[model samples]
Target: MSSQPTSNAPVLHVQGLGFGFPGHSLFQDWSADFPAGLSLIQGGDGTGKTSLLRLFAGETAPQAGSVTLLGMDAVRQPAEYRAQVFWRDPRAPWPDTLTPLTWVEQLPAHHPRWSGEAWRAHVAGFGLAMHLHKPMYQLSSGSQRKVLLAAALASGAVLTLLDEPLAALDKPSISYLLQALEAEARASRWPGRAVLVAHYDALGDLPWCARIAL
Candidate 1:
């Protein structure tokens, strides 16, 4: 693993970022500085929470301005920038034929800090151990979400972008995820490591290093 950058430097820096759909504009000259640790992106529906995450993840390009992740241009150096982050869109379609275990096993190869033991532990912690072999289409919504969460947490990416992370989660699973996120923050294995969570509902007692509302 590479050494972490200075704590004072922002892990993610969005400067004058602008994006819009065909008929609606999401952000106009939006800017923010996200330091290491957990940050919450809270907003109601139609507020572009998911779009913002996609921009940060380099999955969507900004119409104007720039995004810098760990000193790399998010647009110009997309591959290098994205390689340091793990982003999973809840609304994105998945391959229904693949089993959760197979998906998890394949994703980590791209992540330099991938840990097989961590992946298995998160799978069990999120209550997906028994359903690992089942095709994704067969798993319940919550179970499918657990599979994705397990993969993201185990990826060990410096930047983790989670869109609507708390959606469809039961009480126990929510608690488990919260604990895991807290541990990730404290460990700080990657100096510029950050977890950016986009959600519309009240987080209620969850720990957050910073909070931004759109």
Candidate 2:
């Protein structure tokens, strides 16, 4: 579970990348490489942090340049590339009405690495008390965020692309998540990388954080 991206190439490589919406450019000529630790994407509101993360996640096509993970081209090998990364966004949709436990149970059993008990413990760690049978939509926004966080942990992706990961979370939940992430980083001999976009500076004490402010 090392945080390395599985190749000599950077975990994330961006070269001459640019994106625009209507009359404004969100980002342009942005070239950077994310190495084997947590890289924080920091910016004020409307600075395109989410857009850039979406571009990296292969959810949105960048207007120019290239986004590559390991050695695979992002746009060319989208499915393979995306499978290695997990994206968590608040605006993203959830299962229509699945309960937390049922949703986790429905995942294909082929992924032996992600166990139900482990996810259950994770959810509990975040102070979410709902049983798996409870409807997800019935939970508060913060509680829903907890569910999504646990789901991301269970997904077992090498690269973690988190958008506002700390939003709507309490202090204990935040501490719990940071510990979980630290353990995730330690589990791998050379785990993939994690890129977190957040306004909070709580990441200051994280083991290794490279900051890039826009």
Candidate number of the best lDDT:
1
Candidate 2: residue 155 lDDT (0-100): 66
How well is each residue in 70-157 modelled by candidate 2, as lDDT tens digits? 7667798887777667675776667777887777675535233455665777978987665556787777788888887887776665
Listed per candidate, the RMSD to the true structure in angstroms reads 1.7, 3.1
Candidate 1 lDDT (Cα, 0 to 1)? 0.84
C-alpha lDDT score of every prediction, in listed order: 0.84, 0.72
| Candidate 1 residue lDDT tens string, 109-173 | 77888778878889778888789889988888888888888888888888888888878999999
The CA lDDT at 170 in model 2 is 88
How accurate locally is residue 14 in candidate 2, as Cα lDDT from 0 to 100? 90
Model 2 TM:
0.85
